[model samples]
Target: MFTQAKLIITAVVLAALIGLGTWWHLSRVHAAEKAVHAHYAVVLSEIREKTAAAVTAFRATETAWRSAIDKEAANGQARIDLARHDAAGARTERDRLLADVARYRTAARTAQHSSAPTAGPTTGDALDLFADLFSRADARAGELAEFADAAHAAGLTCERSFDALSRTKPATVQAPQSNQ
Candidate 1:
């Protein structure tokens, strides 16, 4: 009979097994996460480098444009001043747009930190420790999985054997044979 005590114990064991399974897989999951973060970091760095280069090129172009506009032999000082003021406005707009793009890119990442290390602890000590722990736990889970399978098969076999042995068979009768 599956008494309450037996039921409770089974529940506990099943829960423990699930917990172990989760821990075992956590190693792989964590590793995958670290890989993704590393990839993103590399990408972000590349983006920053490229952005800086682009900004440098933009400044150079603007400088050249300003030089050309200033050196223009226009007879009207008023027109020259107006053109310079417009160029300044364009510069302001460009700078504002660049700042907005950077801000939005940062915002896209959301909370910025969790389940990952921030610019700290370049040492591999803690990493090695967790790697070892996860490896051992996962290996243990593999062993337990084999045992769990065998136990399941054994339990089913035991139940079927008992059912066959304890079940009552119906009695059968044959008609009396006539003399031949």
Candidate 2:
């Protein structure tokens, strides 16, 4: 049996050890949490940057499509207008894809900050969607090139028709010749 003083000393020592252990555990947890938060911030920042880049590209495509459409419309070439309409539609699809990318980036940022699972599609899904969109844009560009060529040819035809009409001579009526 330990003496009363010894028992008291033992109890105090145990309490002190427990307190130190708790402090150490809490500090370690805090450090780990900070590290996790830093990593999440970095990941979210990367997603944001990629999303912004995609959005910028989409906007540029939209602008180019609009310009091409307006120019063709002003030229009064029906075939070109039709092709430009197709380009505009393609741009619209691109905008939608870019908008989805923006939503994904927003969700990722929110998930990172709140440490919660995002709803609906996963990040991978969004990435795949963007890849598909990019492929479609490439295809659309090729089609646009062909359409432009055809439209140019059609414009030349239109111009030739106008020139031919302009060069036409008016018919003149002559009085009947008098009998000798």
Q: Which candidate leads the pack in lDDT?
A: 2
Would you estimate the TM-scores of all the predictions?
A: 0.32, 0.40
Candidate 2 — which pairs collide? none
Per-residue CA lDDT of model 2 for 75-165, tens digit only, reads 6566656667767787677678667767876776567667656676556566657767776776777577767766775776567555544
Q: Rate the local accuracy (lDDT) of all candidates.
A: 0.58, 0.68
How well does candidate 1 match the true structure in TM-score terms? 0.32
Q: Residue 136: error of model 1 in Å?
A: 99
lDDT of 1 by residue, 1-180 (tens): 669889999999999999999998998899999998987787777677767777777676566554444433232344445545655565566557556644654454343333465687633545446555655665565556545554555565455444543452333333333223
* RMSD over all Cα atoms, model 2: 44.4
Q: On a 0 to 1 TM-score scale, where does candidate 2 land against the true structure?
A: 0.40
On the 0 to 100 scale, the lDDT of residue 165 in model 2 is 44
